[model samples]
Target: MIGDKPAPPVKKTRARRPKVKTGCKTCKLRGVKCDEAKPICRRCISTGRTCDGYGIWGGGGNAYGSVSRITNSSRSPSSLPLTTITTTTITTSTCTPGPLTSTRTLPPLLGATTQHEHRAFEYFFHRTSRKLPGIFDSPFWSTLVFQASACDPAVLHALIALGAVDLGKATRELACAAERVRGYERVALVQYNKAIVSLGVHFRRGGGDARRVALITCMLFICIELLRERFKTAKTHLGNGLKLLGEMRRGEGGRKRGGELVVNTELESVDDYLVEAFTRFNIHSSLFGQDNILLYTIAPHPSCADHAIPRAFTTFRIARLYLDTLINAIYNLAHQVASLSPASPIPKHYTNTQSHLRSSLDQWLKAFQTSLPTLTTHHPLIAPLVTPLLHTYYTMSTITLSTSLSPRDELIYDSHTAAFESMISLMRGVFETILSAHAPLGDEIPDPPGFTADMGFIPPLFFVVLKCRDRVVRREALELLDGAPHREGLWDGIMAGGVGRRVVEIEEGGSWGDEKGQGEVVVPG
Candidate 1:
């Protein structure tokens, strides 16, 4: 009876992992580890799986991967989900056969408190959204902010405030801060206060999507401050918004989708849009080489970076975006080296990064110059409007990369005389383009009277005059800068011109214009 070859000695096995009930529904269905990153999980994204978010909220977790709603006085225990394993799963949590589809839980727009509020909301939807975003045509302005305002009164109030105070003309005025407490500014101020109160109420009640609401409202707040030239306040808000976004990403293991948060649905990813908008604002701040600009580690050199450029860019928009990233990388590397090298020798890694950025920029120039005609194929306006603006930055990036390792040495800048000449030529082209646009050929002017979120000629011109000792080149750069209207992010063309003039006339002990002077004067090696 006991025969059977001793029953193969009873095969041994390891214990199975515990079933993750509190994990995202998608993870449960697929039998994979859920990083449980809020809104969406990292494991799902990296694996190309759609995170169906979490099941029903149990004892206050951020349900369905929305932002965890933290209260005014205290943090929600689940506000920051710092771990992959969750403690607050419904005991009866059920996973459906496929990804479950639930109606997004946004509230309908509430009634306007006043007729003025109603008018202001419509004004924003119709006019201000188009006007405010400028060249930085972000969906956050045109779409997501409006969507959030419809559901959150705080955002609604802020939107009304933003519409009431015209930002397109805000940067143009003088004594903006002193004048903001009266007249139409008073109307905007009232709405701004109301928005703050509404936001505070959400915190106290612990109801509605307070996090997304707060973030949207925060952008409005930043815009209001920036418009009024209250840059310090705007900077503070930008920092806070970025801080909150960092928390949300940390909750998601620092992974985010490309400006959309929802999965298997058309709902807006409020976090992605907000993050993008904030990041662009931060990146543009580097246009002036701001000391507080966020420093990033230089990427390792690509093996064939010079040959990496395509034969032609498919579209102007794609080309523009690619070039912007390269310039920003240069800005980031310069700042990082400046910050890091002072305390010690310039790291070899930074020097290597400088070479990589220089190589990429060289290829960018080659590709861009070759494809200049194709720039306006799809979007006819892009070439005339932004080509010159971008060229200046490309040249500025070259200068920055070359001098990044020797920031304080005035002598190092002399080597980049050709780069400064390139900026002068680019600025001349920009002026010519704008003048031709305003030629009044019985036709409407192209790109008139508006601000852009894109960094424009002001920064490059300012840098050229400051860095280039060739008086003739710097004078022309200053004049070109002075003639242009300023409305690009934090850069003011007139103000930059004044600063550049001061650097030449007062700081360098040089006469105005210094005309008929030798150009591109290179010192002996």
Candidate 2:
């Protein structure tokens, strides 16, 4: 009957719909129609499935396709699997139809992310840079340190470590929590260790850049140790820096015994800046323990001897040079006198050397006077206390020299007394200046960017308290020390002040004189 029905009427068959050529991975895998959407497809979102992103169809068609189809092509020949994407090409439904391609890449350092490094750099430039007193105002801080940090990982780490330390010191009080401070300390220590390890590697490798960075790192280590109050470590780092500098200078000529050619490198302006910093540090360190050998290594500039003075003495550089020379002479003479027998007459050479040094000192004084600024033409940049401080230093140096000649010589003793009086006067002037300006006293003042007690009126004041015999002047010096609570470089103002006061008590109580010798004064470093 069914075969007979076909003869009765010819029935038309229905045509099938065309299959979808393009869709997202989830829709294609599910064998469903894809409502193509950017980023995530609507079909996948509605059906609670993940969209596998969009790609151009590998087959010849103007429709979007799943990533698997485009990536698994025979022509593409990708090392990755069909499921793995090496590069992603994202397309939109807009008429302008080129795919946007993107590839992921890793950063440079494993733990040090770019964003974190940038924050550290910003901290260094704005804050840590200001903590170096003499160097901060120069390009050494603003330019050289930045340039060096960008290229050298050791320097970068050291810089960030310093910034952490500074931040800790600044915020420790506000935080009032040891844990917070400890957190910063841990960060600083880790970074410092990294710098040290990296620097050691560079040193072992040995290159011009290595040597330069080694010297810089050493200097920075010294600064870090000083900030931490680790004097012995600071000194060790300074010694290492000096050694590196010597090697750099020596490597500039000739050849080694193995016939290797020596690298002849010219120093940059930044190197000169570093040398100057080292020179100043060397002199300061010598004052602590009579380590005067640094003086021999760093000869005074020839220009220092020139009698003519410029119209204005705006900076402390020139004066410090002359003062350093005199200090060296004083220590040398003191060593010679110390070795002499108690009953022995002053040696002829000793007298000659003293005379020569005294004459040179006189000339330096004259030059200093000529270079000094007039009241009407004072440099706006130069602090008012600077001139008085210089005067006190000059007077102290003279007294130090005279005292070194013979502790018992009546002429020298009288000269020392007179000079002591002059120093007290200069110190009073400094005190007056601070008062007139309505500025806080040393202890009352907030710590400045690069503040150290020795940088202010404390060092010279302490010297007077330790060395001067006058009760009134010594008492005034002690008072000044009491008013200053800062630590300077390696010198702890508070501790030194305490020891000085104790020494004064012992001397005045006659206990020291009774135990040691009459008129003997023990000056603490």
Measured against the true structure, the TM-scores of the candidates, in listed sequence, are: 0.65, 0.64
Cα lDDT tens digits, model 2, 1-525, are 665545556678866444666776666766678876533366765654545534211111111122212221211223423322122222222122121222121112324344333344344444456446531133345334444553467876887777667656654555355765676677678889989998988879886667877776776777778777777778887777766665665575422222111111111244454555565566567556545333422224333322223333334555654555566556657776877888999888888777777776777677667766552144433445666777777777677676776766534444476677788788888777755654321331233434331245666777787777877777777777666666666666666667677787676895433443423234333
Full-model lDDT for every candidate: 0.57, 0.55
**In model 1, which runs have C-alpha deviations exceeding 4 angstroms?**
1-110, 113-119, 167-183, 201-210, 256-270, 293-314, 340-343, 366-374, 438-450, 513-525
**Tens digit per residue, CA lDDT, model 1, 1-525:** 666565567778966765776667777766666776654466765664444554221112222122222111111122322211122221212221121122222223443244444444444544456555554345567445644554456877788788666532432243443443244465677879989999898667553255567777888898777666677787778777766666555466434333211111111344545655665676667665544423211111122123245556665544554565566567766766666646588888888888887777778788777788766554455466667777777777777778888767788988888879987887788778767755321221123344555466777778888888887888788788768765666766666766676667665665763632223322111
Q: By how many angstroms RMSD does model 1 differ from the true structure?
A: 14.9
Cα error, candidate 2, residue 158 (Å): 1.6
Best by lDDT: 1
Q: What is the lDDT of residue 14 in candidate 1?
A: 62
**Deviation in Å, model 1, residue 410 alpha carbon:** 1.9
